[model samples]
Target chain A: MYERFWRLRGDKTTIIIPGWQSMSYLSDTSNICWFLEAEFAKEVVRLHKVVGNAVTEGRHIVVGTGSSQLILAALYALSSPDAHEPISVVSAAPYYSSYPSMADYQKSGLYKWAGDAESFDKEGPYIELVTSPNNPDGFRRRSMVNRSQGLLIHDLAYYWPQYTPISSPSDHDLTLFTVSKSTGHAGMRIGWALVKDKEVAKKMTKFIELNTIGVSKDSQLRAAKVLKAVSDSCEQENSKNEESFFKYSYKLMAQRWKQLREVVEAGELFTLPQFSPAFCTFFGQEMDPQPAFMWLKCEGDIEDCESFLRGHKVLTRSGKHFGASPKYVRISMLDTDETFIQLIDRLLAIQERE
Target chain B: MYERFWRLRGDKTTIIIPGWQSMSYLSDTSNICWFLEAEFAKEVVRLHKVVGNAVTEGRHIVVGTGSSQLILAALYALSSPDAHEPISVVSAAPYYSSYPSMADYQKSGLYKWAGDAESFDKEGPYIELVTSPNNPDGFRRRSMVNRSQGLLIHDLAYYWPQYTPISSPSDHDLTLFTVSKSTGHAGMRIGWALVKDKEVAKKMTKFIELNTIGVSKDSQLRAAKVLKAVSDSCEQENSKNEESFFKYSYKLMAQRWKQLREVVEAGELFTLPQFSPAFCTFFGQEMDPQPAFMWLKCEGDIEDCESFLRGHKVLTRSGKHFGASPKYVRISMLDTDETFIQLIDRLLAIQERE
Candidate 1:
């Protein structure tokens, strides 16, 4: 797990915050995203440059509570406030499950959830969420709705070298990335958006300011330190004792995927999507996809995969939540070593029972 | 000024977080508010018990990004989902300026901002916000809409002894508090709400989960440490070497108010609110109100006080934002010593110019 890497680093990543430090709500009043700590912004830029995963030059970085909040902010910014009806917000089938409820929970007059971007019809103006290395199904994706009136919000939460090969630096107008998936720091609730347009970025910033009065400065500072440590590890690649963050995480992910694929092949009860080897610019080698979640399909006569797994005391997200068939389930591969091993053991037990 | 007290305490309040600690998003999965850290919740209960400003027993504690987020959470929880129309949200005139926008910015169908709780004569269910020791103008407030369908959310952001006298343990249905105004740790963006009803608390938690997934664990941990230090300071009453947090802050606020009042009286350019001394349970004595902000009204020919002050190189929030006249302005008394002195000097110069 990525935690092992940080544990080995010890006090190197520990941050000390004094009582009087960061006491004010404002970080940089001169900037559009005034609540974003300058140090955090600098580190975000540095990390992206080090990994070459996303384009950061000339982009306005807007920090949020997490990419979850950023998604909402993007919707708020892209939708016209004075529209006669709420703008239709859509994503391809098997999109992130939370999108529908998150967009429509408050019943905001500016936007409404319109399911499945591919089948979205009768829409005048729409916002399309394109989640590459998509959740529920770890396949890379692009915007499905092609229209002049369509605005795109790219969610690249799982585009890191460990999960997927970084083909090239993503050059999108608005891209969201979170420390939760990248650095395994979900508890910090830190995420940033790379925005190409100044007005859109300002509106996103305004949404955050209205939502939570900006993200937490404590989390921002800690995220900066954690990210700096990540970049530092990569920079010290010549030192045999130091392990590169991506290399270390990629190894762990690759091992887990190998074991999982073997179990599925032997069991013949479930099938997983096959991924072709791709050359990664960041890793400087060809690698198979080692996604953070397994898009598992129940083979043969299994009607509901999630319920079957639950009967075996294994928890998995139902594919129905992701607008997919009940025979499919999304199982997380990002849990602790103990949990991952237990999951594999449970799957083997089910196979034996069969 | 209380920063000096914390600074004097040296590294006693310093926290060292191991890299692998608190990585999971789930804090207490069994609890309704799954992301509320156990340590932080315990500290919150302990602090409330120590201060006696609000009741903590048998109350469900919900943590948030700040009282700002909690306000929205409370609104979401209180409003009926299938209502014929969006529920009207009202606060009395001179309410916190951010309330209207924060409530209605998304133009949510769940609720809409209806101005002035006192004059809310609409015949339907409504939510009233009562801010005790209210922002802009520090004064005790109660629910203005007297109806069976009226729900109330109490924002007690400035209820600490340093700002106002703690009259009694407030046992409201839902009460909001934040560490920002309480401990001057605005950067943490941490707040909590004490709710009497289990269903309401659960709904509030859901709102937060949909909004930001959860509050930041890093901020919650740091806030817990800061609050524990505060309660520790109070408990060490016998140690003359250690100044209690409330006593230190109360003295500083009291001193600032005295100096400002003296200047305003001598200058005869403005009028300030008069306060009746009240008994404080926490301080164990009667004390005059020393609010964090000054509500100053322009006298004589001054039609717009905020502009008048701005002309003198002083910045203050206009009373218009608080639903009051332009002849009034709200000045922060919580700025640094240098800024406070300069503000006083500027006011004195304006008086001399007259």
Candidate 2:
């Protein structure tokens, strides 16, 4: 896990927050997102540049409690306030399970959930969430609607070099990234959006202001320090001798995927998505896509894959939650080593019974 | 002023967060509020017990990004899902300015802001916000509706002895508190709610889960440390040698209030609220109210009090924001020493101009 890299670094990545530091609600009052700490924004830009994941130049950064909040903020900003009805929000099938509920939980008049972007045929303005190297099923995706009326929110949570090949710097009107997925710091609850439109950015900032006042400054400072360490590890001279954070993470993912594939091949009871090798600009070589989740389909008459897996003492998200059939389930490839091993072992045991 | 106490404490109140710490989303998965950090919750309970401001026994603690988020969550939890229309949310006149916007920003179907709790006569399932030692005005409040159908959310953000007399340990069914107002750690963005009902607590937790997934574990841990330090300062058992956090804070507030009163008396243009001495259980003595804000009402001629003060280079929140007459303005008493002194000097200059 990424924890090992941080653990080895020791105090280099440790952040000491004095009691008097960042005691005010405002971080940079002049900034569009006033609550965003300047240092945290700087680090976000630096990390994206280093990874070649997203374009940050000329883009406004809006920090949030997490990408979850950002998702709703994007919906709120993109939707027409004066519209006759709530704007429809859609994501492709097998999308993030929480997306539908998050949009509709408030039952906001501004926006409402309209499931499965692929099948969406509404005649008005709509917000499409495009999660690349998507959750549940880790396939590279583009906006399915491909219509001028469709506003896009690109959730690039798993676009890091460790999970997939960095094709190019992603250019989008609105792109979201989280420290949780990139640095494995989920507990920090820090995420940001790179918005091209100033009006949209301001609206997003307003949403955050009305939501939680602002994101936590303590977490922001901590994130800044952690990100600095990450960038520092890769930029250091003679870094070839020391494994870079991405390089280390990439190797681990590759190993895990290799192990998982071999088990699946032996079991012959499930089918995992096949991804063709692609050249990674960051790594400067052809690399296999090692996604954070294994989208598994039950073979031959296994109608309920999630329930079947649970029977084997292996838990997974039912495809039903993702607006797909129960024959498919998504299992995380990013849990701790012990837990991952236990999952594989349980799967193998189920395979033996067949 | 409280910052001075924290700065003097040096490393004792400081929090050192390692890069590898709290990397997961879950804090205490077994608790009713799964995202609530055990340490933070423990410290919250400990602080409440130490201060005797609120009862913590058998109360479910739901942690949030801040009290702003908790306010929304309380509304979400208390509102009936089966209600024919959005539940009416009412607070007394000159209420916290943000309450209306925060409630209706999304134009949520669950609840709608109905201003001025004192005038709210509409029946059937209304939410009444009672902010004891209220924001802007600093007046003690009770639910004015006085009906069984009225659900109450007690915002105890300024209930500390430094702001007002802690007359009794508040035993409200749902009470909210924030570290920002209590400890002046606004940047931490931590708040907690003590809920008596199990279903309500779960619903509040669900609201948080959808809003941000969870509160920041880093901030929670930092808050835990800050609060522990606060309680420790009071329970040092050193024969009254060292000043407790509240004792030091109370002295600063008392002094500031005295100076402001003198300046206002000389100006003869602004009338400040009068407070009768009341017994404080924690302090074990009668004490005058020293609120975090100065609610100033213009005597005559100056119709727009906020604009009038702005002319004197003293920035204050206009009463219009709090749904009050332009003759009144709210000035913060919690700014830095330099800012407070500048405000006093500016007011003295205004008096001379008169």
Candidate 3:
């Protein structure tokens, strides 16, 4: 998906990690160094502020292997320490699919997975996940539960300008961000949370420490470098053209979404969620639809849309995985150009056959 | 203490991580890639066999963020899935100090910390952690609990030739190893478990997946390179002088132990553990006393060895922290030579004052 952008980046994005870079277990401070580099943390704050997607000031930053790890850490942090019974964890339907497993996998006595927050009428302390520009379906969301006993965790993985308009800086108590979706460096496994409460941040840090003794210093160093490069590119004078990574990514995703929408319209076999043009702060202009995922709902007699796509040699995440109807399928729009082209061709062919 | 070795290594130990390296969450195999790189796993096995320390054949290799993470994973894997109650986790006294916190921090309810296997006379399912060439105090160890219901996980972090004699290949059901202690790359945060049971390996992998997804690819790639370099040096016919990493580490540690012993002998303030000369397969000769930690026992009126050392401007881990007497203090022998020299000077100064 990002081949062209990386081809342009060439050697600038590459980093040499010294064998003895972080040979000692000790970092600057015990808690700080466990999985985070002080420099990397600073860069994360800087990048988020520059993008205007997340509120960094007055927020404690907790780094993780990825947002996936942070998701688990947040759940562990949110759960009551002295509670006799496990708290219920719920998210609305069509949520980020991993929430269920990430919550229940430990079979942790501290928390248990309860379906959709809209129906969660139970009386007790609960954690409700609010994912903005939600996975599977790209829609901005807010927490449905408004109880004093409820805790909210905002997963802002796709809130960056490339994927959505920055309506305002997210000010949730706890919000998750990742370099994978922002800078397209998924392999680095660097994610962070902007936490309002110091106690919660400390507990999350402890969870990370006990879980992995911290994230890899090499990955942290690399993330710092990549994030810096991204910030620099965004701030460049000639950034409007192909030189800026943000502009380049935005253009690619927008173009793909347009082409995909066109093919789906021509086929008339599927319909896409409608997204209106919104003014983006970073771009300083009205932006087109650029969702990370394409939620395609099959029309007519087609059922089990994921299996239907799979039969056409185009693999997609089933809506059932996201606790939705089987008629809907989630296709990744962030894949390589070649993959995108193949997917379009397959969808067009299937449409013709139908 | 290993500064000389690192200085000799210089830039050869550095690795350059490309921005686009291993971007996809997916690996060669879904589970395999999450926990390990096939090549890195192969190198780990090869290096252990070359050093004649761990038996790798017919074993399932599971990688972790660090041996620390694996320690928890092993405990989780060893616990019964169907059991209504949490399993008891026990280790011998003066065990790795992190064992207690690591086991209980999650409050998983899957397992609970039970102190000292020798004193654990419980009649229930239990998991015993046996650290051979144990932490704090270096001594060869075995599982004290011989019951069929008891499961053993051997932590062989210090079983390398530099720390102890590799008398023979260790063939345990579950063995943990790390590049940090063996190659002095603690920052890499890469650890592996050689498991005899496939089911346990799968569970360990699942725990890692649920925890941090998997170990860092960049760290794994770097470890593979370092292990290969270490193995190459060990096999070199001309590595007899000081080129060999193992020989260099052993000689430096052996010399430090000898010098420290002489100073302690003169002071009569503290005493070190005694270990008989043991045959080392790697060196093809009897090895001298070379342990990772100096287990110092204070003599006379020194009530707390740690506090006594602290007064001399030398910091040491208290024996009370390791569930041992306050008269004992554990000092790291793995620091820089300058630090080690300063520690020795302080000890001598305290002795002179006494």
Candidate 4:
């Protein structure tokens, strides 16, 4: 497909050739988000002066869109899909929903999920995702778990400054990061992964070149600028009210946890009494128990409850979207304290009216 | 891959997915460039307003990159490649060089130029590019051409107000327009096509979605703005020294052409004895064509000539890049008067030294 692209684009093309592109020796700024080798080197060098030398010390940095969905897509494209050797992707249950879509792009020419690595026959498997400090639970990989083999895509999109100090790299595992959480730039649509290997980096680069033509250059620049600013600000913590940001972030989350706890204590809710993090989930058990969802064990039409919640101007995901039982709905703690309170108050009113 | 992305994305994802996206109602901005069936009605309305009301008379007023390259590629992707059909790609020789590339993308590939429609073995060709009031040379199709089979990609990239006063559309052709020449914003990279077939339009949309993840919204906006500015400027042309700009443009081109014409007329030089009116070329016949690339062609060692041009603070593409005779060269009149003069003087000096 790209061969045709190169042919028609003409030899007048100054930036790229049929099979290779020369490193930009002479800087041309027609595009700010080129993300080509030079732009990558230029940006890393320009930012490293401010980020310090840790960036050069084998940090696995993965970059992508608001969801890390693009990152996953990149991973699939970079892997060996055409080899006669069989390969499959594997992830733990209750994984982020977009994984199937990422894997589907490969489609194995015959099967969906292509026998996810966990289910892959011993003869062949390709990639595995191990979420360290996992989402919805913040559960670190148990130190004794002998998980190995296949490429491991470690997502750490949410493990930014507030979850863990940036000054310390979590030895828990190599991970992904995004500004959506750490810098309140979710609207910015930027994400990156920090991989500890060079071959992985080359493969990822090739995949990205094939997809989306790389991220918006303007967005990347503004994002990199903002990131540097944040890293700088975090470094100069001696300033007045410097530590307050994380404190406020924690306080905001803790307040919502307290509301759910109160509801549980009042017999309006029941914790599955599972081993999970205080921050990762808010659960209540019914006949069908899922450890992560915001369970509403009530006698009512699931659709009707969803409509009722919408009517109250509070929004959340339907459990059905996740292919879960209709009796449950999931409420994430991403909302502000005020919105959370409004939601809780509305829920209490629903019960009172019933 | 996305499963890892989701699993690793830390849990603070408090984003409100746009209700329109969930309901799938709002027009996806990404689909705006390609005309999908779902988007055809909206596009027809838009096409009626922007391109011409005549576009709404049928289902195809498609948009693409600034050079119509998008539509050319689109038609190729939709066509069958291995069919035992008499499918042939027919276009005039000295055609838009990109025409063959477009056909190859479809895999029916480029058939040899059979000169005219009477000889064109057009029983089953998928795509044909018929540029009228053709580019380079302003030769509009003179009506003997047959358009019964095969999709036509009209790269009338240069048929505009300033060039041909009598230009008009053929009865059947997929017409294209580019802002690069029409508005002098090649760098903006915006092109639009009026595809007459709805199914073809729909297929193009799908291919584009796979190709580059939609055109640059920012670049599109800039092109629109510049075009509007040019339009407004045109409205006030009589009072705004409109004649002066044309005179300047012509003067600039003519000055460069004079030096070039004189060199060729001197009999010591050889060039396209007759070439496109849009450009003026000169080749070294007796005067050692130091580097064969006096135009985009170079008789000299390609790499060495490129080095020479770079050292001399000049730049010209080589013919090999254009699928033209290796020693042939092409030059552009798309520069300001000063630059054109500089080029002319430089050429003269090189000639004198030879």
Top DockQ hit: 2
CA lDDT of A26 in candidate 2? 95
- Between candidates 3 and 4, the TM-score winner: 3
Candidate 4, residue B333: the lDDT equals 56
Q: Any runs in candidate 4 off by more than 4 Å, and if so which?
A: A1-73, A80-91, A102-117, A128-149, A162-215, A232-354, B1-228, B239-354
List, residue by residue over B1-354, the lDDT tens digit for candidate 1.
Answer: 456766776476676676677777889999889999999999999988899999999899999999889999999999888998999999998989999999888989999999989889999799999999988789888888879999999999999999999999899999999998888888899999999999999999999999999999989998998899888888896575666889889999989998899889987789998889999999889999998899999999998999989989999889899989988999999988999999988888888887
Backbone Cα, N, C clashes tallied per candidate: 0, 1, 9, 37
Q: Worst lDDT window (10 residues) for model 3 chain A?
A: A26-35
Q: Clashing residue pairs, candidate 1?
A: none
Off by over 4 Å in 1: none
Candidate 3, residues A18-82, lDDT tens digits: the string is: 55567876666755335568889888888877888888888888888888889888888888768
TM-score of each: 0.98, 0.99, 0.95, 0.57
> Against the true structure, what is model 4's DockQ?
0.06
Interface RMSD after interface superposition, model 4: 19.8
- Highest lDDT against the true fold, candidate: 2
Global lDDT scores for all candidate models: 0.91, 0.92, 0.84, 0.43
Worst 10 residues of 2 chain A by lDDT: A233-242
What tens-digit string does per-residue lDDT give for candidate 4 at A261-282? 5664554422322333332211
Q: Write the per-residue lDDT of candidate 2 for residues B285-346, one digit (tens) a residue.
A: 99999999999999889999988888878888999999899899998999989999999998
Return the lDDT, model 4, position A175: 48
